[model samples]
Target: MKLKFTLLTLFLVLISALSFAQKSNNSQSIISGKVNISKYHSREELKNLDKGELLTLYIERIEVIVNILPNIAFATKPGVTMASLGIPETKDNKKALEENKEASDTYFDSTIEFQKSILPYSDKKDLIAAILFYESTLKALHTYEDFKKD
Candidate 1:
């Protein structure tokens, strides 16, 4: 009786442990870096990107906002002055804009914005180092271009 009871208890323990294990999600990949999604933007930031005058106009406006990022990053990396864009100081206003359900469909229609949303949860923690590591990990795992489809 004692032997049978011990064996049953061990089997139940193993089954519970396996049940709690984390499984991989098909939509995302884990690369070798980190990033902080919350620091740069919130979910609301993406929604606030447009005034939503009209569906077509809103899309165009959102596209313009999304398209300028690479250029700004490249330009600033080279130490270009604010005078180039006529702005006195450059700011990283990557905060997620508030979502407006009535304005348009899919606030984060672009891959870049979608990628930003995933950053915060990637590390499972909100520390700066975790975020940086998560950013790199994402880059190593997936391409930015594919983010939209994801």
Candidate 2:
């Protein structure tokens, strides 16, 4: 029947479109970086702060990154509500975080270099805006993706 043929054609088109999408999505790599959170507070300060203060600090910093996602918001906020739990950082973690953040910076620099390469294009403003927007979006995505781990 014509209806059956039409349905099959539509399904094939959808399958091909999905395959194309996967390829495009996989082409661009993720940016790497980890930020050390200890700089925001000293060991003395973290030790001294009560649960309420630590919770406030966590909320203040993390809120912007995860944005409106309820599931992710839930994972971060509730359990750690108890504070004065002692500092989580060690010398090793600090060194690791520093290295991760450095990698992030390097990735950012590469993106900038890419923009410079395309700067000679006629649409200067649009090109710059697009690249800048991409950078900010990537930064946010990177933070959001690494929320629980870092």
Which candidate leads the pack in TM-score? 2
Model 2 lDDT per residue over 10-62, tens place: 99999999999965532111112222132344445555655445444443333
For each candidate, the alpha-carbon lDDT, in order, equals: 0.36, 0.44
Clashes of 1: 24
lDDT of 2 at 133: 43
Question: In model 2, which regions exceed 4 Å deviation?
Answer: 1-87, 122-150
Q: How good is model 1 by TM-score?
A: 0.20
lDDT of 2 at 118: 50
Residue 53 lDDT, candidate 1, scale 0-100: 20
Looking at model 2, the pairs that clash are none
